[model samples]
Target: MSEHQRAMLNHIREVNQHIENLVTDYWKAYSGIDTWQFWLNAVLLIIPLVFLLIYIDRRRVFQILFFGYTIHVLMNYLDITAVLKGLMYHPYSLLPMPQSHLTLDASLIPVAFMLTYQLGYNRRINQYLLAVVIGAVMSFIFGPIVHAIGFLKMYHWMSYWVLFIGDIIEYIIAYWLTSFFFHFYRNDEPTS
Candidate 1:
C-alpha cells in the first residue's frame, strides 16, 4: 500500500477503536441501572447548566427558575400528550419521569434563550424582538433537526410547524413571565 493509504487506514482504525471504547463505557454504566443514580445523574447534569446561568448573572436566580418552570410545566404537558399520541418519543432517559427530556426543554434551553436576550439588550423592544428570532429558529430549524436525529422522534406530524409552534409558544410565555416578573418585582436583583 502507498504511504497515503497506510495513514488513512491507521486513522480509520483509531476512530473505530475510540467508538468501541465509548460504546463499552456506555454499556458498563448502564448495565445495572440504579433507581437513585437515575435522579442523581440528572442532578449532576443540572448543576452545571445552572452554573452557566449564574455565571451569566448572579442576580437572576428566581427569575431563571420560575421562568424555566413556566416552560417546563407547559412543555411537559405536551410531552405527555405527545407520547400518548405517538407524536413524540425518547430512546433514553435518566429518570422514569413522564417526559424524560423535560429538564432541558423546559428548564434549560428556553431559560437560556431569554437570559441571552436580556443580557444583550436592556430594553423591552429589543428583548422581545430577539426572543421571536430565537424562538423561530428553535422551532423551525433546531426542533426538526433534533427530531430527525432521533434525540426527538415525532409521529403523525409532518408539517414541522408543530414543533415550531411549540417552541414559539413556549418562548413567548416563558419570556413574557420572566420579563414581567423582573419588571414588576425585579426578582433578579441581587440581595444585599
Candidate 2:
C-alpha cells in the first residue's frame, strides 16, 4: 500500500480502539447487568416480543414478521448513524459495550410497529394514518419517558420532533416494501 493508505489505516484503527475503550468504561460505570437501567432495557427488549407472539394473527404471521424486520433494519441504520454522529445515545443497555440502542431498535420499536401494521392491514385502516399515530406515541410518549428515566440522552442538535419524523418515514418505507413483496408473491402464484 501507499504511504497515505497506510496512515489512513492506522488512523482508523486508533479511532476504533478509542471507541471500544469508551464503551468498556461506560458499561462498567452505568450500563452493566447489575444496574436497574439494564433490567429496564431488558424488559423493553423482551416484553413486546412476548406480546407479539401472543396476539399476532396466525394466518398473517409471516407478513407481519416481514414488516417488522424491515422496520428493525431501517431503525438500526438510522440509530447507528445518530449514535455515531453524537446526536443521541442510550445510557443503559441490556448488553455491555453496546454500540447502539439495540433493545429498542431490534425489539420494542419493531414489535410495536409490527402490531400496529397488522391492525391496520386487517381492519383496512389507512396505513399512513396509523403510522402517524404510532410514530407520535413512540416519539412523544415513549421517548420522553425513556429520557426522563435516564435511559436515553440527546445532544442539543436532536429533538423528539426529529425522531418522530424519522419514525414515520421508516414506517412508511417498510409498509411500502412489505406491500410490494406480497403483491409480487400473489401475482406469481401458480394457476390451478
Candidate 3:
C-alpha cells in the first residue's frame, strides 16, 4: 500500500481505539444492573416497544414497521451525529454502547411515531398535522421532562426546537418513503 494509505489506516485505528476507551469508561461509570438509571433506561426502552409489538395494526404491520424502522434509523443517526458534535448526550445508559441514548432512539421515539402513523393511517387523518402534533409534544412536554430528570443534556447552541424540527422532518421522510415503497411493490402484484 501507499504511504498515505498506510497513514490513513493508522489514523482510523487510533480513532477507533479512542472510541473504545471512551465507551469503556462510560459504561464503567454509569451502566450496571444495580443502577437506578440503568433500570429507568430499561423501562423506557422496553415498555413502549412491548406496547407497539402488542397493539400495532396486524393488517398493516408491514407498513407501520417499515415506517417505524425508518424513523428509528434516522433518529439514531442524527442523535449520534449530535453526540459527536457535542450538541447533546446521555449520561447514563442501560447497555454499554457508543450511543448512550438507545432507549430513546431504538424504542420510545420510534414506538411513539409508529403508533401515531398507525392512527393516522387508520383514521385517514392528515399525517403531516399528526407529525406536527407529535413533534410539539416531544419538544415541549417529553423533552422538558427528560431534561429535568437528567436523562438528556444539551450543549453548544442546541435546544428543544432543534429536536422538534428534526423529528418533524424525520417523520415526513419516513412517511413518504414508506408510502412510496409500499405502493411501488404492491402495484407489481396482480389484482384479482
Find the 10 residues in a row with the least total lDDT in model 1. Answer: 31-40
lDDT of 3 at 25: 81
Candidate 2 lDDT over 69-111, as tens digits, reads 9999999899888888889888787766646577898899999
Q: Candidate 3 at 157: error in angstroms?
A: 1.5
Rank by TM-score, descending?
Answer: 2, 3, 1
Ranking by lDDT: 3, 2, 1
Residue range 1-192, candidate 1, lDDT tens digits: 999999999999998688557644553464215534345446645864776665655565676667667876777777778876778775435544434564456445655664655564444456556656766776677677655645567777734677666766776777787778779785665889
Of candidates 3 and 2, the better by lDDT: 3
RMSD of each: 16.9, 1.2, 1.5
> Which candidate leads the pack in lDDT?
3
- List the candidate 1 regions with Cα displacement exceeding 4 Å: 1-51, 106-108, 120-125, 183-192
TM-score of each: 0.60, 0.95, 0.93
